[model samples]
Target chain A: MRFISQTSSDGVTEQLFTLPATSGDIPGVLWTPDGATGTRPLILVGHGGGQHKQAPGVVAQAHRLVTECGFAVAAVDAPAHGGRPRSTEHDRLIGEMRGRMQAGGDVAPVLAELHALIAGQSVPEWRAVVTALQELDHVGAGPVGYRGLSLGCALGVPFVAAEPRVRAAVLGLHGAETSAEAAARITVPVEFLVQWDDELVPRATSLALFEALGSTEKTLHANPGRHGAVPEFELDSAVRFFTRHLS
Target chain B: MRFISQTSSDGVTEQLFTLPATSGDIPGVLWTPDGATGTRPLILVGHGGGQHKQAPGVVAQAHRLVTECGFAVAAVDAPAHGGRPRSTEHDRLIGEMRGRMQAGGDVAPVLAELHALIAGQSVPEWRAVVTALQELDHVGAGPVGYRGLSLGCALGVPFVAAEPRVRAAVLGLHGAETSAEAAARITVPVEFLVQWDDELVPRATSLALFEALGSTEKTLHANPGRHGAVPEFELDSAVRFFTRHLS
Candidate 1:
């Protein structure tokens, strides 16, 4: 599919490229917003659980960030989602999502030291995703960030904290299957947008994470809505949070 | 599964009961509330597409109506949903609801018989659903109103417009699929909780129904939310809405 082009406020254009999956030759779109400031701030977006990266709502927002916000957004089409290899096991897998439940997320894995695909999150891979993002910022134009919705939100925080290059993050409509291990590791500036009333993800677990984040700079944008919510985007709040920290 | 129990203001205790479908049975629930002033306004809560009535969220809301706020709520598990019949052919026909595609939400049939559900809607089963609600209401209480979420919200309004006992309605998180159809046949008081910023249900379509409702008494309780919403339970706005209309 053709990843549409968008125009940013800085008078340059944004281009959609593909990040071929390392596991397989699957192709996922990576939207590169041009005209980024000197030392570009990278923003890598991720997919929600049980959904692909190009799901309509996610795509709309990706387009908006590239076009309206002028941010370099690498929207990952993770394994088993978007253009990556299909996950044969999820449909038949055991109940609930856990690290043990299923796998396939955009991360730099180190063990293989082989092709980027087939890599595990063996410390090195995590560093690689962050390293690549930082390099891209210098190549693309400075302060890089990360954000995700739903499952993406669940993974984005830890990934951001692990990779020092990611200055901040905006996690939206997330809270399902939160990892306390991941929670403890999140020491960077972070914000959570949760539909506390949503049933898709356990709200209590998210509240627990909110309280547990190591950073005193944490904030929670609670939308009194349901799951998979697009209506309560809280764009201004998110933009403000990112701008305050990223700048 | 178990239904929730609640106590009313006048010290009346009631149990929420679901009508089971035993091969030849109609499935529904009678959720009794307290402080009946001679006759209390009853609300027939409808389930969304391809979902059972007794799902955890539905059951919890039934409790809220019965216990927290005083309103008699009767929810039905529609055919092919909940403890209802399922056919391989019908299941295939229901289509998959994932990533912005839900099967069988068309309103062409619903508009054909603007005055009713059975003849007008594309399918006869939903009309049967309307009849089931009416029959159960008559058996359990005097008169009742209607409330539905998502697909149910789209179907319930027309059903209530035709059923006189339905004094008021709160159509949650849905709008007429087509604009021309939405323009026709609305007479009762309605509170259209239009999700002004919703991503799942496009904003334009919702605006169409809001503009079409001819009832001067109709009010719009538009929220910044999405489709998978339980209006009467989680949100304080929902509780307030029920308080004003149902009481």
Candidate 2:
């Protein structure tokens, strides 16, 4: 990965970078709390679908992890999202699927297949970013944790499932049906959040994804609201969850 | 399949029957319009998870198909649910999966594996039910169509994909991630219903399933509600869809 820019504000350093990827290059941002000397916990924050590493939610969460929780944070643009160059085929498929859905058809399989394809590409990019981070000075040597939104959950489940370095996770705002098989591979502690009345995801599917995890220690935190209405209190709870487990 | 009883009410004749199977016997209900003519469109109705063939929704839908749409309808109990004797293994797995979800772990893989196994059995049973229905005088010899609910979509996707006799389908109230490849084989017209605010299925996943269908003509009818909150008007829409395609 090559750093594109570095800026510091409010006792935190934010570095924008791009990493060579099989599909071309992956854009990302990493946040590190200022005045930190040695090893500390590293948290990966995944953004929602149609978003990127720089999305407000991702930046806010990463900022919280850095400033409040004293951790380094990293995030990457998922395929067809953010600053990453889009594939015509992917865009076409997504467009077609969305159109069909608007017309009253079931196109979930196509979306899932596309998600899996992107996830397959993203997991490696994440691994590479982590490796690049480890080479930097003043970075953490502690356990790695993950916090992902809906699209994040979709890719993060399988990514966390495959990466043994991800010791704990906070996943929510998405149903687990797409990554159920990968969920079974997650043996680490997890904090799953769900909006009881999610407009975009089904409650049973979310619960089922939680059930698919092999982790012996996992907690479900359900709140009443729509998909994007996650309570601000929950972010604090997630910070605590990672602190308790990763730190 | 052997007939157990027949009752007529509201211009519809409901027949109760049991079909021999490896698990013992599968109980089913078939609804035919009273004073029915020969060779009318036949629609196979598949119930939701945890519901019997005689569940109110299943019966009500069947009655409407028979009395209003001039179609014959049939439904059977899924293995380990309703009249079919539960397998200790199935119950144990479900219990374990549910327990894990309650503990905030992911158990979607287990549920999916179980769903696949049951779909394998249910598909054959559905085929046999159709064959048995063919021998009866009240049932029709016309084009065959399928209408499956949540669990029904889980099993029905593969069933319809494999059964060439089923010319059209109405599937939804579930995601098609588990049956994407099978969905790709369904080239007939379809009308898929989804609750935009479904608690167990995700909107994108539902759209993906619709995209996966091989059908050149498929319609999606998404209502704003929870998993079980499908509007009554959608059923009427489904009946019209099937009637236009099958009749």
Candidate 1 local lDDT, A179-212, one digit each (tens): 4555567667766666645765566666565655
Identify the leading candidate in terms of lDDT: 2
Please, what are the lDDT tens digits per residue for candidate 2 over residues A202-236? 87888788768788666566555689988776786
Every candidate's lDDT: 0.53, 0.82
Candidate 2 lDDT, tens digit per residue, B4-78? 998999999988999887756889988998887677778998888888899999998998899888889999889
- DockQ of each candidate relative to the true complex: 0.02, 0.01
Per-residue CA lDDT of model 1 for B1-247, tens digit only, reads: 2344544434433444443333334555655544444344466677776667667666666666656766666676655567756656444444332211444455343332332322133123333443454454323334456667666665665566556566666675655564335435666656566554465566556656765766555544443345654333224444455666556
Error of 2 at A227 (Å): 29
Clashing pairs counted in every model: 19, 32
After TM-score superposition, what is the CA distance of residue A76 in candidate 1 from its true location, in Å? 0.8
C-alpha lDDT of residue A208 in model 2: 80
- Candidate 2 residues lying further than 4 Å off, grouped into runs, are A1-247
State in Å the error of residue A234, model 2: 43
